[model samples]
Target: MAIASVATEYVFSDFLLKDAKEPKYKGVRLELALDKIVTILAVGLPLFLISLAFAQEVSVGTQITCFTPFNFSMKQAVYVDSFCWAAVQYQADNSPLWLHKFFPYILLLIAILMSVPAALWRFTGVPYLSSDLNFIMEELDRFYNHAIKLAKNLATLDDRDAEQDSQSALDLAEGCFKYPLVEQYLKTKGFSCGLVVKYMVCQCLTLLVLLLSCVYLCYYIFLASLVDEFPCDVRTGMLKNDSAIPAAVQCKMVAVGVFRLLSYINLGVYLLLTPLVVLAALGPARQSSSFLQAYEMLPGFGALSKFKPIYNDLSIYLLFLKENLSELKSFKCLQVLELLQQSAEEGFDTMCVLQTLSQVKTDVFDSQKMGSITNICEMDKPKN
Candidate 1:
């Protein structure tokens, strides 16, 4: 009985603690900090190493093999480098002078290759995250607005009409649920979500591309860093019978060290960039006001005009129409239309189109009228 009481107390305490824990509601501090730190190090160390390697490559050149004595042919010089390099085991013991000749440039190539992906990931990945952030922020604003609207309705309700008001509010809520504030916002914003979607897809593609690049770099780095100084057999093709040609040429490519550093840096940056991108994508998905923010640009277009997938289509069409009108002969009819239409469209800014239309001569109507219009404005086109 004593044990049971103690166990029950412990169970109750655990339940209470769990119930007390509030969900992180917004900007929710949801990232796994451990994974973040690990990613940082994993990404940073390689980049740091790559940078260091590059610095070394930049500071000290990679190739150092000397041409054999002047009397010897190019083949002989090749032979000298080949014979000496093939023997890194021998050079380690002997410390020959040729190894020092060609070291820097080889390392530079390595550095460049390694750093390429790292820089690319950053350049492409962060924009994706930013778009997602905007989406989240927009949704939050809309949610806040909806909440305000609900509170307002609740405050002004009449006791007798409570059921009716409740039903109306419920219907509005139901509609909003089917088509979120974020969705409405997206329409008002003019199909910008399409852009966001495109950006996401592009980011994913870039992620995979950068990852593949990193893998390729890793393979090359692994092999290159192993023994940068290697012997090349130049005995193929036409050089078979050449006694002057050494069996192998000692070519120490100095670029590998720099390349390795670049690769490490590249990997780290991409790893960081990619995850942030994923976060960005997910953030927009969960953002509270994403739909609302997109729509807020237009004040009251929701009831009659639906948001289209391509928001700017009408605007683009209007501009094109304006351009077409500008080429015409007169604007007598256009000025009147502009005077009438400008207040309504909040769009199809007819100023240029009207101005262009106005330039067209009304000479076809009457001589006296043409003369008056000519006085009001110059008609550069041929008057019919």
Candidate 2:
């Protein structure tokens, strides 16, 4: 009774006492490095270009330059430049230079629109995926440790003590094998198409935004090619009756060259991102099954075989596992367990028992830490 009570207490205390060595939740990053890089380029490039455009505007000190009549004063030339820029859109005879005037603002809009997909993924998909990954990873860690300890105990139990109590061994095994928590947890996560839908939505949004921006840029470039200079009649509004002012002035947009260059750069980058987003969306579906099949030789990996259609939640989890495989200790642990299972054919039943027990023992108790049955029974002895 004392041994049983202490075991129960140990289990509960283990839950309350977190391991100092365990990583903090914030440290777990499931976002693909590819996604991060794409997002940075898509959203940052336009903003950077906008800054350049503004800097060019400041250096030149004006957006338009007009050829004023030699009879007019210096102030009249400045006025012509300002009036043509302000009234450029209102002139019916000339091609609208509104796009040229508002080029920096347009680039800012493109940057905001480009960030929409990344923002959607961050808010809608990231929280869900992060929480799921964290839970699955924690469970995997526990299972790995339990399996290692259980395997060691199984290996040395006979050699360590010849007359060890059979009843104590049975008690320990029964305690350990009582539940299969990971499988049960996984089974409950049925039809997690929500994650897939969210992921696809973000990718589709990115593609749509990229395509539209590229089209707009192509059109802008076409328009820019045809018109950089236009005739502007500045003798309107308050100055309509001024006979001294010329009927129209030849005005040129000073920043058209800079705007065109920025457009081409933006278009080129967005085109590159389009293919990357499409690849990211399709890559997982292509490799999910093939990757899992590689692990089918593992004894309990039959669970993975059921993921034939591969879009399910478990498959997604496995996809993430593949992404983070190098960082995961659990994969190495599972490989170790598989090797042990393959080597000990005669003790197959014992290994099966150990694996099953390891899963629950991870949650409920760890008898190996107690050292031996003699140590456990001694705790139950009555004190004088």
Among these predictions, the greatest TM-score belongs to: 2
Model 2 lDDT tens row, 35-86: 7777899999999999999999899898888988999899888878887888
Give the Å shift of residue 245 in candidate 2: 0.9
* Per-residue C-alpha lDDT of model 1 across residues 1-384, encoded as one tens digit per residue: 465335434432322212115321233222233324434543445555645655675677533364344577777676655555554544433333232232233334434543444454446643543454345434534443453345345334566897899789877765665556544543454434443454345445545654665565566556545665555555657878878756655466555455556656565666666566565444334333222222332223232133232323222222222223322211223233333343333334322222222333333444454344334333322257
TM-scores for all predictions: 0.35, 0.75
Worst 10 residues of 2 by lDDT: 354-363
Clashing pairs in 2: 176-357, 177-357
Task: List candidate 1 segments past 4 Å from native.
Answer: 1-58, 64-193, 234-240, 290-384
Any idea how many clashes model 2 has?
Answer: 2
